[model samples]
Target: MDEFRFIDSIKPSYYRQSSVIKGVGDDGAVIQPNIGHELVISTDTMVDQIHFNLNNMSLEDVGYRVMVANISDLAAMGSSPLYYIVNISAPNSVTNEDLLYVYQGMNDIASQYRMDLIGGDTTSGHDLVISVTVFGNVSPKKKRLRSSAQIGDIVFTTGYLGEAGYGLSLLDSHKHDKLNYFVQRHIRPQPRVDFVRVTTNVNRICLNDVSDGISSELNEIANASNVSIEIDWDKVPIHKDMNHLEHSRLKQLALSAGEDFELVGTCSKGDWKLVRSLCEKDDIKVTEIGKVINRGEEPSVYLNEFGEKLSLDQSGYQHGNS
Candidate 1:
């Protein structure tokens, strides 16, 4: 099938969210925004070989992973996903049926997350690249920006760290398929949208998706908030499966191997009580990983590992540097 036919076929499968007044087949998507709410939008792209490899991941996993990466951005902002646009560029090596499988993965996430797939472009290219832009909305007062961190606030994570990174490693090493827990975490990360939804009424927050790992994320928050943060290595949560890893490898993965898709953020010490209470109600456990210590020029992040205060470098995957 050609580009137009592919778009036509997927039109009916789109999840028509109330906010999307018009979707697929149009020049643009028409969206009805909620009154008194702030619009939250984020975009992400994944390329074959650079971002994903078929040897370890299916085309569908690539599609699903890209969508979740975008959705996690919305979750970090404490917003509910409303609509999304996806652009797929496929090479001669990629077939129309393969694109459909990718779409199925995207559609699955959209259905499960209550967002609509609206409009985007399809093209033949030298590489298989999927780009997604997601739209969400939150109360104006509840917006969670990386700059929102405050001194004395408690830093937290939505779930276990390092699982996704290890999962991808398992696939790369050809040791386990996608069904493995760590592998599943890498391929299909669960965005913390539900937790954000439940705690929407909480105080202002500082948030960054652990898309690039906690080290990079914490540095971002520090630079944005102009605040230094301190955290104990032992406080960093990990899966029981990761316990077998040597101390150095576990530390390396938790610190710099990104794509966890969990939210790392901060709230007032008092507000954390409410946040924890709210999360526990849904059987979700948000781990308190650290605390903001100072606010000033030249902000930095310090990790308390092996009872030593060690400053962290600006870490995680750099797209073009590799």
Candidate 2:
């Protein structure tokens, strides 16, 4: 049989639970616990060519990132991860050592997050692809969504921006140490679990994972909340390393370049100081970057400094753009 036909030949199985069961679906197998909470389930895929270049990334990084990126989605929802399922596809040319390194990397991250690897599928493919479905739990009342923001809620991001794009820039020059931090940020983007945990009590009004740049994510949140967002350029946190780029271009990059893997969230005005202190206690840098305004502003981002509004033409890196 052909490859596509072969994959299609296998049928998915179904399962049923007793009367106490809450929900179950193919996205993930779930069961209600004695405690009342809605378990959030999500999955993500990382392709060799599209998500990471095999030539540029190590085997270990590939494995770790596949899990971390999926975990990021759960973190944005303030979910406590319980377990995960991994599915990997690789070519015959891939060596045993490479495969083992990838597994090791996955295990290392899983152990740190105390996530259990419940099940998975292994398959042979022409190239490489890793997909993971992570299961997490959060109280229904505490669930954070991008659609919940109210006008006047202050916007915040967990860390400085543009490091991932900057790291990709150095790959050509092969300047490893010159941009070690950014490189690491891209290779092993940390899942902001603890930080999300800290903000859970502050009534996290809205939430987004900064996989795409701030502009893209801000636009998404604004559209969801039916509100306009105004970001102060000066208020957007920029790391010292980001200063390597030219002034005008760098600001644009920081605002538009994607894959920063930070958390951008909203909080009521009164909770700012308390949230700031909570993050400080956890050693996480939280910056007040913007605010949600009336929808009349049309969901735009701005650079208002020195009484001038500079134009940033790029809308971040899109997959198919040349």
Candidate 3:
């Protein structure tokens, strides 16, 4: 099928939104946000082999993942996703059926989040690349920032860590059991969009998505907010599947696995209690792992492992790092 036909194949009424004055088929998309709301925009690109292994991941998984990566950014800022544009470049080796499945995958997530597929472009390339640009809205008072973590604020995360890292390991071993929860996580991560929506409604503060590992994310919050962070090792939530793994290795994965897509942030103790209670009502688990310390500390991130404090290693998925 040709490009036009491909676009037509996936067109659906569900992809349309009132705010989108014009979507797909136009030179550009036109969106109008409601008054008293600020728009949050984020873009992310996923390259084949580098970001995903085509041999291991399905076309649908690729599409879904790209959307999650971009949407997670919006979620980190306490914004609700409104619209998105996807640009895809696929090699000659990819079939039209493959491309359609990709769109289906994207549509599934878009529908779930009530987001409109505004517009995008498709082209041929040496390898598959899916670039997604997402738009969201947040009231000015509810907007969260990575640089707003305050001293003495309690740090929390939405869910357990290290599952995605374990999942990727299983995938690398050519394991194809869909029943394996860990393997499922690596391919289709569940972004903490709902958590952000609920928490921001109650109280908003310093927040970020754990896309590049908790260690890297904590360092980012520390540097951005000019504060030191101390994590209690015992309070960190580890995936149940990781119980069999060596304790040290599990800790390493929990700290450095970059694809978890969980939310990490800080809030006042009172706000933290309120947020935690609200999340609990929705069946979402929030764990308080540490607190923000004063600035000017020798080490920005400290880990209290069995009462032996140590500096955390800032290591995770760094593009181009050998």
Report each candidate's C-alpha RMSD, comma-separated, in the order given.
3.5, 6.5, 3.5
Q: Which ten residues in a row have the lowest lDDT in candidate 3?
A: 313-322
| lDDT, candidate 3, 289-313, per-residue tens | 9999876644388788665777775
Clashing pairs in 1: 167-182
Can you write out model 1's per-residue Cα lDDT over 284-304, one digit (the tens) per residue? 879998899875457888887
Ranking of all candidate structures by their TM-score, best first: 1, 3, 2
Residue 43 error for model 3, in Å? 0.8
Number of the top candidate by TM-score?
1
lDDT: which is higher, 2 or 3?
A: 3
Please list the residue runs of candidate 3 whose C-alpha ends up more than 4 Å from where it truly belongs after superposition.
Answer: 14-16, 297-299, 316-322
Q: Which candidate, 1 or 3, would have the higher lDDT against the true structure?
A: 1
Error of 1 at 245 (Å): 1.0
Clash totals in order:
1, 0, 0
1-322: candidate 2 lDDT, tens digit per residue:
1334322332223222231232222344445553787878899988888988867788888888888888888988888776777777889887555666776677677778776655566678898888989888888888889888888988999888887777777764676753387788888878888887887876655888888788777778877888777667778888886766787678656777777778887878888889899999989999998777777635544445555644222374222210
lDDT of 3 at 194: 86
